[model samples]
Target: MNTQFVVGESSSSSPHLSCDVFLSFRGEDTRKTFTGHLYTQLCQVGVHTFIDDEELRKGDVISIELDKAIEQSRVSIVVLSKNYAFSSWCLDELVKILDCKQMLKQIVLPIFYDVDPSQVRKQTGSFGEALVKHKERSFGAERVEKWKAALTEAANLSGWHLRNVADGHESKFIKSIIKQVLQEVNQTPLDVAHYPIGLDSPIEDILLLMQSGCEHEVRMVGICGVGGIGKTTLAKAIYNRIFLQFGGCCCFLSDIRSKVEELGLVKLQEKLLHHILKTKDFEVDSVAEGVNLIKARLGSKKVLIVLDDVDHRSQLESLTRERSWFGSGSVIIITTRDEHLLYGLTTSEIYRAKLLNDNEAQQLFSCHAFSYFSPPQEYVELTQDIIKYSGGLPLALVTLGSHLQVRSVKEWRYEFKKLKAIPHGDIQKILKISFDGLDVNTQSVFLDIACAFHGCYEAEVIETLNACGFYSESAISTLVQRNLLQRDWPSLVMHHLVQEMGREIVRMESQDPGKRSRLFNPQEAIDVLQGHKGSENVQALVVERRALKGVKLTTKAFQKMINLRVLKIDNLYISGDVELLSKELRWLSWEGCPLKCIPSNFPVEKLVVLNMRESNIQEVGLDFQCCRSLKVLNLSDCKRLRSTPNFRGSRSLETLYLDNCSSLKKIHPSIGNLDSLITLSFSCCKKITDLPSSICQLKSLEFLDISSCSSLQTLPVDFGDMQSLRSLFA
Candidate 1:
């Protein structure tokens, strides 16, 4: 007896002699002979076998040791005899086996054992009779229910089950099951491909560009538009188009706002290097060094690179240099909201991406809201109203439409009314509705970019966050996985509207202007900087009544934040003695501050705008030499400003307003250097001017308002160069 036990134990435990065949049978029904024949055949093939012993176990309970033995076995051979469900322990074992299968992703092979699967599922025939008997027994309904559920679950799983078969062919079925399992173990799963959002006709253009080859210097295509108008979508569409055509290509979807807030650009550069080189390990310690390395490695390869959702021109300069940095045939695609961002790059290479037309918007909306090609009869009116509110913006349309999908017409109408009634502060209110559905961490990151930082460095944010004792890279990664935060070229950026909306939330929460003054606590600062926390307070550090005086900054100081939507440091000083006018800020407003000039090499590319509307500045120098991304330069009422600077390289300058510069005389001759200039208003600049012939070179110029330029008389005869001039208010 001891020797028999030893043999059984050795068969079950030995690695080489492990159970090659496990018999799964109801003890009272077929364990006596049917399993015996199967075991004999398996043993003949030098396979170890495990057969449950009914006598070894206590009454009504399955032995714990037996359960473990069954779980560890390589394969289970279930005997579905007529009386299978009669044994309660058998039902328990079957449920455990199915649980293991699901948890471990194990292979399961079922045998019909002279009974059909249909009977097992429907609990008909002998199986039904056994369940009925149990229900009628002293055992309660709950116990019977458990057994029924187990049987139903096991029967539902996809596996091999036999019916109307004999012991003679049992070996053949077992061998076939083993062979199939082995084959499955050897095969690898395929990697999932990313789907490009908003792909359409633009794909054709990208394909054509690829087919044309490197004959001409590789062209850089710029897709410029307002936030959420599908700039990133169009670029993604283009990327997907060429990804298959080219042997080497990389799409860097970095958001400048989020990167500066989280990891900084250094980590982003490292990721870019690793992805481009196809290496698992790489180091990019700084932005300058990373830029150099990227240029060196990518300079020779005829590759396709895409930088999506850019907010700053500095981001463009930092990532893709002159087309010369790449091979002759390489292609670079950049997407941004600010048209001024395309200035430093070639004008001929830029493409102003427009929002989707009514038909397209409606179709996109219908896809999300109705789940059909068109709106349903009941919700048609409400859908149209919702579409109108979206203003042909794809992101807004898709988001709002998705929320309304499958909802009742009443719900749709109510939502539409609420959206229409709400005042438009920033795009964040609309975005927050979507963001609120995300996990807490994602919401925190979204608000961080909207409130405290933009164009952030990923690594710096991470490092600063580590100091604050908030380590949740996984949570930040999860946000990226969900597409809430995106990588925009070398840095990270939030959607323009998203940032705007986030700031709005921060402002709303900080109802008291005084509370806004002390919001940036160190912990809160790190959260705001690294995109891990939302601002609960606001602190506008005003410099001076005439010039900003030193104001206490929150412990979380701005070190590497690159993108800021609204920076109103009115009359605030950096130190008690030094002036703080030289800081690189976007949307800077020193209304009454005593300041002279902006800092040189101040990363002007990052400013999608500059608003110094009401400032007391006498010497207004035109040293905007590096502010390539300055789309709108508002020097509205600077009465002391006398002469504009030579903006030769501000090629992306779309709108230049020198309104009310009463003392200003001669306009910069290089003002005509703007090829992409759409709106040039020298309104109220009473100083004399015989406009230069170079102004005629603005073939794409539109809305040229020389209104109130009393000193100006005859128009340039070469005005024929303003072919695209739609409204000339002279």
Candidate 2:
């Protein structure tokens, strides 16, 4: 009889064991039959198995080496043949394997080969006879009783039964056994995040989506969001939680964008197939061949695959092009910045990653910065500053928090100042990848919004951008799809860090603020205008109220800015000829202006928006006669204004707001010429007495507000002809 313990390969210099499975069986009964075949097939599939190959005389106790192997193994397989219970060594191995299963939570699988499961469980037939003979010998009663109990407990476990398979299908049975062994072996969890705060809810939400669909159908899920928004982290957490449920037929192909660039799709496909199949023998020569192989091999087995950081549609086409490529109940997850990449996927659900809320952001930040759940009392205010600046992005919070760890309060303040001027380098690099992939025109449009149009109404910004020779509609759509921009109701919103990155790009264009393409800093703009350092490179300029308290612009201040298309000034003093402003201007917002009137020579033909609310102007200027492209005109709270300007030349005007122009007296008859007017508000224009008949000719007018016009007497005779008016605040 061949009775020996077979030990798998273990590196002598290594400190830990590498064995995945330990085999426990009678060496003589099925040594060259079922047990031997099982061990060989397990080895062929790259499983590090421990099998007894050495032949020796029968002994009552198993060797120490054999016991240690069972303890170190991740799983133990017991091949129970007719005479398996006859060997004392096999019974001792069973007791040790069961002890490990309880103490170490090792997986135990009992294979009832050529024997009924009930025979093993009840210790009947050969099992009972062997134990009775051992008891009759010098073996202790306690040892015999322990062997019998281990057999009963192991046989009760959920395991394979050879008798259940077809009559001549032992090969199929072995294959099924190997598949289960692999499932238990590869159930190791992945490292999700250092501080996985706020991860539970998202994971639960994704799980619900997974279960909401029919169990027999494959589902593709896309997690889309801007960079640093935690798409990959959420995907990883979901993968870790459910990977074992798929029976270890799972693969997480991380950083797929980078992997594709470094090693072609064929290599990635090979890695994916090798991971799920548990073998490295399959070779893919090309992407097409790999696709066919994946569809053919994995089509029958349910799998979980996560494609992280996918950037292109082609990546999806090559990796998970069709739902039929995967089996029923299979789930394919993809995380990407561009949501459009998921549009072609069928039977899919898209989950947009949301920014962390205040509580979650605090907890996540505190974990990385202070190594606690919240910040210390001494740094509460500073911590809030960091959280606000992070704008709820998890990546920003984590990276910035880690950067500020172990630093003094003063250092933290200084670092925050630097961060405001420039986003974190790593974060910027990641976000810039999406920006860098855009076409030249779209990039310019993005820069425009990042510089001057953020928080502005989407329609107004689009009009202004269009006036500046951009295809604003398509560009804005592209930006939204890329996660670089978001439409919040009527306005467009960009992440604080993304805006900083875009502005930083403009800042790097030239060392001098005058030479840069856009100027957002009030001081920088004041300095450029005051020093007469203006240049054609300056395309947009914004100056806030506090910075313009004592500053005044001269006639030549904007003469050299020939390409300037956007200009926003707040409560500023202008002591020069406004006619010298750039003719290319498309957007002009001058709040608290002290001028009596806009000079007739001032350029307004190309202007799309003219907002001078709360200004000191006494009259609506005739210069508006050239504003054929103007879409929005807001002159609210200009208390000294008397009447509306003639609208003969402003045929494209869509929104006109003269609300709170207290001294306004009458509506000009030329208002009938505005065929495109949609909104007209003269609320609180208390001095106006009557409405001109031409006002009734506004066929496109949908909103009209004349509330608090206390002096008005009556409506126009043809007022009911304004059929388009939906909302009227009389």
How accurate locally is residue 262 in candidate 1, as Cα lDDT from 0 to 100? 79
List model 2 lDDT by residue over 1-730, tens digit each: 1111121122111113449899988877777888889889999998999887554324667777787888788788999988988888888899999997775556789998888899999989998999989998869989999999999999999888888965548889999999888767865657778778887677656666676657778888889999889898888777765554465688999998889889988899999998888888869999899899999999998898999999988788878899999998888999999988888654338888899999999999999999998999888999999999989999889998999999999999899998887778888887888888899889999999999989999999999999899999999999999899999989999999889889888888988999999999877888888999999999999876657797767768888999999999878887777778999999999889888887677678899999999999887666556777989999999988887886777778999999999889968899887889999999999998899998998999999999999999899899999999999999
| Cα lDDT of model 1 by residue, 1-730, tens digit | 0110011111111122235445678877666566676666666655566787876466666788777766666556677778999877777677776665554333456666777788877889999999888777756788777778777776776656553333436666656554443433222211111222234455444444444434546767777655666666666545533332233345455555456557777776666666555554668777899889888977877666777666555666667867877766667787765555667665556665555677777788888876665787877777777776776767777778777777888787777776553424344453554455456655655565445445655643443333223343754564453334556644567654455555555556654433442232233333443342323233222222333234444313333232223354544432222222223334344454445654453335445455566556665554565665566666767777777767777766666677887877766678777877777777877874667777888766878778888988777787876779898777
Tell me model 2's lDDT, rounded to 2 decimals: 0.85
Ten-residue region with minimum lDDT total, candidate 1:
1-10
All candidates' TM-scores? 0.36, 0.81
- Per-residue error for 369 in candidate 1, Å, reads 1.1
